[model samples]
Target chain A: MREPISIWCFSGVLLFIYGLLIFASGLWELAHPLLHPPVLHQLHAPIWWGAILTVIGLWYLIEFWPHKRASQPKE
Target chain B: MFPATNLWMVSHLAGMVAHPQSGLIAAITPSGMVRLSPVDLIIIAVYFVLVVFIGFYLKESSNTGEDFFMAGRQMTAWIAGLSFVSANLGSLELMGWAGSAYQYGILATHWYWIGAIPAMLFLGIVMMPFYYISKVNSVPGYLQLRYGPATRALSGITFAVMTILMSGINMYAMALVMKVVLGWDLNFSIWVSAITVAAYVALGGLRSAIYNEVLQFLLIWAGSLLVPILGLIEVGGWRNLEKQIIHNVGQTGYLHMWTTLGHFNTNPMGVNWFGIVFGLGFVVSFGYWTTDFLVVQRVLSADNLRSARMAPILGAAFKMMVPFIVILPGLLALSVLPFKLVAQDIAVQTGQHSFNEVLPLMLVRYCGPGLLGLGVTALIAGFMSGMAGNVSAFSTVWTYDLYGAFMNKKASDEHYVKMGRWCTLIGVLVSIGTAYLVQHAASIMDYVQALFSFFIAPLFGTVLLGMLWRRATAAGGFWGLLSGTLTSFGLWEWVERDPSALRYVALSPDAKAMAQDIFRALWAWVVCVIVTVVVSLLTKPRPVAELEGLVYGVSPIPEEHDDHWYQRPMVWAGVVFAVFVVLNVIFR
Candidate 1:
């Protein structure tokens, strides 16, 4: 059987990278205060944003992986 | 992070905004550079890489003419819906509207809500079945099926030219933003954007463009979400933002949407409810949302009739949130950014600068380095997506509608696909020249909206009457369209020749170009409907048997009853309408 090409594969990878960037930016903002100030003077906002993005990314990965794997060739 | 950098930017922005005559500063000093931090660079790099990756990934999927032009009719509702809105949420929208917000205040939100929501809902519920079930490849093809070949040719050629011109304007706007915010060279910026859009669109065709649009949509949200959130917090929430705006501008009307629209003199839009309702809402908005191929092409790519119907509805839902990010930032800039000009004489000596840089200025003031990079990337993504949307639509229409219809008459699928690719490249190159021509306009957004009134308003009148009224004949469609377009041009020329002439029509004396645009659309639309009806009555109409699925009552409705009640198009449209009412009431 041909492998099913899910739109999720494309959307998932893009979201995952975006999530990781937001997470890293939050960590960087926390670590280097003078270089990158907390956006709008709230330290917690970035952290929360990071967590939300990370979860969205993980959700795409977890939900779509089985369908993707099931359609792959056994070899 | 850098207090010194912040101080420098604030002082420079103050110099620019104090004078109203100059456009953007001719050149930024070395200190004005918005350098991306390592983290920010990485984020932007990843964004570009992903865009290229998606284009290449979808290349193989577009093997045939159908796949290349229409995505092989395999798009889900969510993907098509997101792409539909993303194609619209381009640089012209983000930057142009933010500047408009700064200049016109929250009245600009009407363009997003009442100006858009109803028409989008109408498209999904009433028009999608005709478009989807008929299986016409392009909107012009539908015209051909409904009216005749002549109507299709007129509309198709005009649409092709307009789409390319729109793409060029988008490219020009994007380059202008980059030059202002990042101090990038203007020509360099234009060429880079032009090349990038042409590359991906030519390779992956409509599917690649749609996929990238979905990706860009997410980035736009993520990048722009912070502006309102942080802006509200800084300004002490929505009430405070309202307070600050009133304090800054000395007007309570700026905060309320529909309340001030009772009279032309009361609102910043400088037009009354009649113009907003009958002109923008009924004519301009409906014309753009319902008939513009830039957006309809996305819906046409849907996998099923249900998906096609749901696409615009989903887009309408997302369209509601746009003003929050794009407009609120402009309002926020009024409170935060400085407007103390260099000096009256110095402004004369040094050249005055406009506040068109409102969004970029706010970004500099609010966002830190990493987040700043992401935000800038979002702006670039928006511009490219918009250009790509225009380019892809242009190629499809040019290849299928004009080239295939008249030039070749009978060509293989492979031959047409090659022609589409060539058209895509030529379209982008021509757009680069069109970009240069856009410099004559006073404001980018106003220029774009004016183009809509001139071209699209009349087109909408003809299409709307043709779709619902089967009595509309081919001669009526052609002559009605021709007269309406000519009427719009004459109105514009008359108004330009004598500024006082509009007062005779009951428009305000001091009304800006935008208000004139509204009235112009109204006149053209009226002319179109009257002419179409009169001509159709005098001419022989096509037989009812021939109309079939192309007309409203001539054919059986597609099998959509098996779906759940909640999933019905009417149900979704009702929900959208309810939300639209609640929003207007609250804002009013």
Candidate 2:
């Protein structure tokens, strides 16, 4: 029997995906700014926020990864 | 263009000034909508895919009735704890309370703090043991064990009806928000979210709903944490924000929680300390936190008695921090937004934004493309999770308390499991029907919310008495609950018929609508207790042997063998309560 996936892993995967997309978008905006950027556009919030999400996602993914040898439940 | 009734209803319920006839044509104009980029769409699409995948993955484990309805009772403290709190953290609540903070200042923080923390702690430390030991599947089941079948049936029927209607309100509110914030069509928003929530909850049952709720909790923080952070940075720091708010509003009382609460007229909320303490803190908070099956079901999914006890404590700790995300944005809007947010009627007439738009407006001010998508996804997740919570609880109560108890007593486990899934779909359909009803009438939303509030305080009185006092007879319980609910409804009607009756209900002419609500709950609870005590004294009591596990003193609590002091539920609850006190004091 296959082990059940932890919610943390699912969260980590989604956060990582979101972080990558947001980071890329942030970099793109930095290169070519929009016609009417929002307030504090100079802060590059998406880049930092995305990076923070990425690091936290990586940590959760590594910490809660399912063990290959076990079929028992994992918290 | 949206109907004037729809905009009026949404804006009115969202705590903006309601003028149903005045803003009919210009309400929610298309030019004001925020268009989502392709990147934003992808983020939302990803969320839908992931939730559906979770439902599919957990399908095999959810075959039995126990597993389907209660997640096989295998959730950890953190998972159950987060789901417990997240169940209440809906987008409507987020948007409405943020608007409340903007309109009423820091006084709105009371709802998250004193109004919630102590009740939640009481649930964890005092109530959880009986709930866990009784081995009941739902709150109604516990009532049946403690009181009688009549009390259980009454509560079960009311709860089942209330949950479904509330789910519909959530659905309609979400669609209305989507129409006002984005350019999304109302039907599209309603159908898509309803289908997604229905599909996942039906496929995976409670486990799917719980997991999604946990994920939604994180998504809410990820999406909304930016608003306060950026707003603070923009306006310098908390000190400077306070100064800016004082300069803007011309009053320093908006920053204090308790000081202005001495007199109703002194505070922006127009609620005094007495109402805040007994009405909100004791009655309304306890009613909602301790007895509401939607949240109690999450705690009941805990793997053990210890985990069950710890879950709400953990939830309370996190709950104390929620005002930072919910209330701070509104305060920031008061200080930092370049344009003044008028009432809904004026905003529609003048093409300016209203107070309820603070959260979305703040999101637009700070977030660009990809970040905007995350924020929007968070709101969607919050809404869908709320629907799922209501639907899932509705299914459980319907199957176990109503159908299984009354209709088919000899059904097999497989039969009940099948019934549960079918009920989930049916519940969603009914909720969708209700959403359309609200979309048409709009005034039904107010009545539906009032209907929900009618049950909670009196139900708490009944449940608390049942659990604590061995002499609380079944007849007493039934009459008390019925009278309490009827009293609440009667009070609401009286106030509706004569607006001046607010002074009688709320105890002061200076008291506002919020104070009236709080006082109404308090009075209903007091009436319930008085009636229950009077009736129980006359009625014959249940035998102590039958009340062993249901009543407090009669039941023998199992000693928790914790390896460490920190693992004790009492220790954590104490720590949480101390912090809660400090927060109230600091804010006061």
Top model number, TM-score: 2
What does candidate 1's lDDT look like per residue over A1-75, in tens digits? 434445666667766776677677777767767454534746455566767777887788777653423454778
| Model 1 ranges off by over 4 Å | A1-5, A35-39, A42-44, A65-75, B1-33, B338-353, B436-452, B505-510
Q: Chain A TM-score of model 1 versus the true structure?
A: 0.66
lDDT at B480 for candidate 1?
92
Residue B302 shift from truth in candidate 1, angstroms: 1.1
Deviation (Å) of B62 in candidate 2: 0.5
lDDT of 2 by residue, B1-588 (tens): 001122333646333223222221134343234778899999999999999999998888899999999999999999999999999988878887887789889988998998889999999999999999999999999999988899999999999998998888889888877766675677999999999998899999999999999999999999999999999999999999999999999998889999988898998888999999999899999999999999999999999999999999999999999999989999999998887877766765665677777888899889999999999999999889989999999999999999999999999999999999999999999999998997777778778778878899999999999998999999999999999999999999999999999999998999988787788899899999989989999999988999988999999999999999988999999999999999889888
TM per candidate: 0.91, 0.96
Instruction: Highest DockQ: give the candidate number.
Output: 2
Q: Which regions in candidate 2 have their CA more than 4 angstroms from the true location?
A: A71-75, B1-32
Q: What C-alpha lDDT values do all the predictions have?
A: 0.77, 0.88
Q: For residue B262, what is the lDDT in candidate 1?
A: 77
Writing each residue's lDDT as its tens digit, candidate 1 over B78-120 gives 9999998888887556766776677778888888898889889
